[model samples]
Target: MDELKGEWFETWFDTSYYHILYQNRDFTEAERFINNLLGYLDLPKNVNCLDLACGKGRHSVFINKKGFQVTGVDLSSNSIKEAKPFENETLSFDTHDMREVYKENTFDVVFNLFTSFGYFDDYDDNLKVLNSVNKMLVSEGLVVIDFMNADYTLDHLVEKEVKTLDGIDFNITKSYDGKHIFKNIDFTDQGKEFHFQEKVQAIKKEEFETLLEKTGFEIQNIYGDFSLAPFNKKESDRLIIIAKKK
Candidate 1:
């Protein structure tokens, strides 16, 4: 096993075990969220869309099915390779960093879903991602960022848990400081023990508003969850923001 240091995602996300650990993520819920978003936006057919940090391209495939020209990009080569099989006339997958602009003024919609942001330790890197998203979008183009509500998450924190899947026991421990949340995962497979960590910044609504405004995005709407309910800071399970390029 590799040492769990530096950027944890670079090693953890590239391994097959990472896929196994998260294979049970609710795809149905994600699909429904995409459907609701599409219905609300009512975008014209064949519009260009970019799925930022699109691991395995599930959401990208869903968007492509709805008649959009979708391009899914991720930093994980393993994920991009797995997503390539789904590519067709209007759908494509590539390996790219979200902090850099892949294409300028090209996409009608740019989606950064499933709390994919705030991985970098440096706060400025997160702003760079927003700038990249802004640069990629056309005039008045939409950017949907689905993030976790920091306050709610810290209030409802799960400190520890154990999950047994496929005959492997995963011991998970979670902790949150004022600035970031950390998940420490330890498990043994075939008599070998391994440990990994996931760290995400606890970005609040006000921070997002400031970042969007600074990036030239006008806030259009905010939702509390995948259901698209209006955001309530104290009670929402998720923070979903819809902003338009100014």
Candidate 2:
């Protein structure tokens, strides 16, 4: 896998509507997803957490407000720079490529929310991030990977849609290439338009489980949504997994 090919993530997520989508009025729903995943882990309030690919500090801030110490990392310098103003004693953000392992056994919980895992252009490059994450977890530490239900996403695929957030209109289109899901976004505000493309690997559940197992993590729980309902192939909006280091 070519490492440099995945650099598009930095541009697509940094200065685009990506921030608006998660930080706008939908914040309540985002908070609910974070809290629900946290509840399933049942870790101590003071546990240290690593928010991988943390965008605009959404989930990171929520975790901090819940009394956990959080360190967020993202490839986007712009997002981290914006996140700096929102940090406190318990919350901090840094700009780093997730493929590189920095701290070992440093976090009791490593949270990768909102399908942030599959952004890499290649499957193996994506697995590098998971390998690094596996090394970051403490013994018996918890890992909560929140992603869209791929089967459902494919079954009820929405090829194109228009949505409004923070008074801006967004035209979104999706393309699934068997292994990758590409989203083309056009944002319009006050007659100004901006466009960007984001590609996330459309990795299936079995494939993800294989990645986890190859990286030496044991899959413990799999849920279809934030509510923690059991995963069903035909029904579910989200695919949330709780795994432990083996």
Candidate 3:
């Protein structure tokens, strides 16, 4: 239960406030993306799937509803506990680290969605995640990584904002230092002020391609957005990469 391990994500993501801050994420849009991906992949019914970094099993639930067996894994024990209610014969959730391979050559598809990456300070740590993904896949299995388009994000950076949600005033500031984007979030809850920092490495498309190549995956396709549009470096909101095991 040592949530504060020096990593910003290790502390921030375990709090209830994190969920409150992101509660407005578009579920319909995510569902559309998942459906589009499922159609595009045309994976076999019986093949197992892994929802890597699946927070609270939303995507896992959707995929399982599509009749695919899924195992959702996340680093947050609280997330796993909340997700366990959705488990059944074909759906399960476990607390796990993405840098370690949970089951070798077991899943037909692995999904790392919603910018649930780039948290590690060291680039090699990110590479370790890719290696783990590669090891967890069957031969020719597919992996989809959904990440923010760094180029576009840098171009459209919002420096500061103040918002009130549920009577809590959140003051947020953002900055990017070439290699990483940092967000400083300040808020007051129950008369006590609190501050949290979130840092994500600003990994680019070329860097990801290099990592995937090094990890023994063949690049299958790259989409620009949740709608499966072709990737345009400066225009896309998301960088969705689909790769197959070599």
Candidate 4:
């Protein structure tokens, strides 16, 4: 397949080193959240779902195991390639852009989890993703979005740190403008120096409310953390939204 055409996410997320850097991401916590969410959703046994920007399929694999037909798509071919080994009759992975619809009226649920959004510099592209997802869902289908609480994240931002993973010391610095968060990564590997950047919009809850409303979705529930508590803009670790297509 042709490589997914995009910007920084297209390049940075595809690198092997990216996986290495975040290798310790907590699958257990993710699974626990999934369990809580699925239990709350009580979706049918045979419902079809999509995992948008599903890098390497950790959550996709587990979601499929819970008896849903799951299709995982990511902008990175390398991530799709890594995720393909777990594919089966009911679970599949593909390389696709999130701003485009994969299939019209195809899925009963769509999951954009783990802060997999806010990559685009163009705000319209953000609308494109939600609009395409709106088109892709069946009537009243659910879309679950797990995103960072911009205020809380900024408040707790670590300005600088170095993490040594697999004998490579990754020097990292994080900064936030009034609009976006920037993480600068500098490191040396095999005597070659490298620098890569990650940028994400610090979209607030009110902005999301506007986005969902404009895109024909009804906000069903909003949670603060993985445990599914009520959202508090000041104290929450994550902004978990469950919206239903109108």
Candidate 5:
């Protein structure tokens, strides 16, 4: 279980490096994409929404502002701590492992966004997160999974790149496993070096569909991009799946 062989969660924090990435970000694209998704999903207001692995509460805040009651959970304390002050009556964030089963059938929607799946060393452990997602959804409840278009990503792979942000230099490399992509980033700053790694499940369209079916979810829709367009292999930047509890 090479995937389970690493401290992925801790390294995930280092890769995103909350304070830095957020500060350097351009939210315009994210704002547009999310707004489009909200329209496509057409979820009703006043519903309970759970954002699993909701890092830094960016999506949670956006959704809450759109009138949904949102609860966000992640495995990183640093993210939870960073997200806390942004919390309000309609939104909350906490630290929780996605692999654990939560209170069953309590949410109207459970969303795992931004390629957040496929990291555990054990394949079954990774699958368990889907079970947990299903358990959190009410009858006929919806779950939306938004991940990178693995095929597209693989084809467009950039083997190595150097990026300097906030005076830190990141030497990054990316490669693909059979079902996921592995990224290693070596960070250098002020004569010191730190390595960060992340593994994202590189599921084919059929693979994700099969996983959803096996998890007792009824496939409702699949989109290739955030604009809710039909899925086309050579044309989309994202793989967005919408499913409902059976």
Candidate 6:
């Protein structure tokens, strides 16, 4: 699809251009973040992990390498296809929606990393995701949510930018309209123009605290960045939350 036709997330994320635009990803940072999280959790050997919205199984592969049985699930079938070759006896990939329980009370941990939350238009759908995670996790199992700090992101928002990757130039614009952050991407590839819009709810820390507590999860820690640093509203880059099912 050269133009935005279906849902923003599904259509855009499944496109080849999306992968090409983000090919030179910061893999080092992602690895470091996963390393810090796994070390801090200090989970038991061979514990089960469900990597929700695990695009291309990056985190799932890393976790499986750490001796855990990891199952990665994403909404994009293309991403799952890309990740299937990495699977082994203890690692697998599938296409799944985060708003539904993939398996009830089966995983010792659930990971919703890389700002995967807050895409739906309905606020209650976010609650549905949390609820689904609650059902998917066993009692006392942990859930890690790595989301962007909405306030900090809005404060330092880039209105416009052009990123050239793999000989393709992507023109992007971002803005926050009171309740949601909107990102409009425009680019031309192979002489055809494409446009995609990404919208995510600008839910804040207080909001997540309420949602998690309401969904039977007790917040154990709130870090502002992947370094496990204390949260600072004005300066931190990410809002990483670790919670346990009550």
lDDT of 5 by residue, 18-87 (tens): 3553476656777777899788778889799998988888989998999999999888888889899999
Model 2, position 203: C-alpha lDDT score: 76
Cα RMSD, model 2? 3.8
**What tens digits encode model 3's per-residue C-alpha lDDT throughout 1-246?**
123465787688889888888888899999999999999998889989999999899999999999999999999888999999999999999999999999999999999999999999898999899999999999999999999999999999999998777778879999999899999889889877888889998899999999999999999999999989999999999999999999
Query: What's the number of clashes in each of the models?
Result: 0, 0, 0, 0, 4, 0
**Which regions in candidate 1 have their CA more than 4 angstroms from the true location?**
1-6
- lDDT winner between candidates 2 and 5: 2
Cα distance off (Å), candidate 4, residue 129: 0.3
Select the stronger candidate by TM-score from 3 and 6.
6
Residue-wise lDDT of candidate 2 within 157-217, one digit each (tens)? 7899988888887788998888888887777666666777778887778888999999889
lDDT of 4 by residue, 1-246 (tens): 123345779888988778889989899999999999999999889899999999999999999999999999999999999999999999999999999999999999999999999999998888999999999999999999999999899999999999999999989999998888999888888877887889999999999999999999999999999999999999999999999999
Task: Return the clash pairs for model 1, or none.
Answer: none
TM-score of predicted structure 1: 0.97
lDDT of 4 at 85: 95
Query: What TM-score fits each model?
Result: 0.97, 0.89, 0.97, 0.97, 0.92, 0.98
Residues 176-210 of candidate 6 have per-residue lDDT tens digits of 88988999889888888888889999889999999
lDDT of 4 at 94: 98
Give candidate 6's TM-score: 0.98
Candidate 6 Cα errors over 4 Å, as ranges: none
RMSD vs true structure, all candidates: 1.1, 3.8, 2.0, 2.9, 3.1, 1.1
After TM-score superposition, the amount by which residue 65's alpha carbon in candidate 2 deviates from its true location, in angstroms, is: 1.5
lDDT of 3: 0.93
Candidate 3 ranges beyond 4 A from true positions: 1-5
lDDT of 4: 0.94
lDDT of model number 6: 0.93
Q: What shift in Å separates residue 108 of candidate 1 from its native position after superposition?
A: 0.7
